[model samples]
Target: MTMSSLTFLDRERSVAGPGYSRWLVPPAALAIHLCIGQVYALSVFKTPLVARFGTSETAIAIVFSIAIVMLGLSAAFGGKWMERNGPRKAMFVSAVCFSSGLLIGSVGIATGQLWLLYLGYGFVGGIGLGIGYISPVSTLIKW
Candidate 1:
């Protein structure tokens, strides 16, 4: 969890040599979008979550909505921090947050705590999605 570990993600390093392919940038950006954009598919889990938690569909839907809302808020608010620090850091942190949210959400599921599920997946994961979704745009623009 040091900055040095994230050097490979640096914009300059991505094209550090003449052999680097500018053509690859779009695909890389696409991959990022495809990955983070899977949030839309989360609705597929609604029925399963309801059965597992014995909760109403509305509650689960609220969790999904909260995550989306937090995504917007974090992206808007975190843009400046990303610009100041760098996309590499932002992306790495987002990965951590995203993964951490999943892990935390699992704990909630195991313990049957709805609040923990919302805090973990909705709030934390949403922040990760926001930061991750926007992380590569600046780097792509720079290229």
Candidate 2:
């Protein structure tokens, strides 16, 4: 992605134009929230994941637990940085982290390596989830 897309450093230009509708922001935020919130449904695939990976249910559940833990950690630690850098950069980074996690996790699954799955979906993706999760809240508050 281009630098402009990742970082909206210019505070003035980042603001909504005069004709913009404030009401539209909530729906947009809701869309993002809905997408991120799907992580909670990982349990739905627990049985299939167990069979595919030949692992116990507890092992598979670690992925969810780790990601959730990291989400809170990153949000708490990264908040100040996100504030300084603005939501655009945070959101972009989050998107990259989350997307990369899925890609890497796929590789891990294909190779039957549980560690890769944890690293990808838990550590890295969790960071993305945390940052992306908070981005809209900050932006909406600013608006």
Candidate 3:
């Protein structure tokens, strides 16, 4: 994409000016964190998910395991990318991934497809978790 086509998410455009509110960073970062942290509440759905997918609790639990694993992996690997590109892009991508993951995982739940849970809430959401996590910290530091 050309510079002209760049969205607000572009680091160049997202950069704060002299009057920018550094105080705004914490609230925004907190919001992102709250959204991402919701994944931890998955255990409450374990029994329901097991019934929905006709799977054992262990199998359902694997979804959480995958998500946590991917979160770690993505954070470890995605840090440099976040550093190079800046936080706005990373957080936007993170939001998309997270929301998409929830949608996809819901579809999986609706359709009784176990793998979709693994792919959606597990893989995609985990990427979101990682990116969402790092973006704010980096951005706050920069600010």
The candidate with the higher lDDT, 1 or 2, is: 2
lDDT of 1 by residue, 13-111 (tens): 443476877888788888988988877887998898898889999998888898899899989999998887777778888999888888888898899
- Would you list the C-alpha lDDT of every candidate in the order shown? 0.84, 0.86, 0.88
Candidate 3 vs. true structure, TM-score: 0.91
Best-fitting candidate, scored by TM-score: 3
**lDDT ranking, best first:** 3, 2, 1
TM-score of 1: 0.86
Q: Would you list the clashing residue pairs of candidate 3?
A: none
Error of 1 at 9 (Å): 6.6
- Rate residue 17 of model 1 by lDDT: 75
Residue by residue across 1-143, what tens digits does model 3's lDDT show?
67689877777777678998779889988998888788899999999998888889999999999999989898889999988887888888888988888889999998899999899999999999998888888877766
Q: Each model's TM-score?
A: 0.86, 0.89, 0.91
- Compared with the true structure, the alpha-carbon lDDT of candidate 2 equals 0.86
Which sections of candidate 3 miss by over 4 Å?
1-6
Backbone collisions counted per model? 0, 0, 0
Better of 1 and 3 by TM-score: 3
Worst 10 residues of 3 by lDDT: 7-16
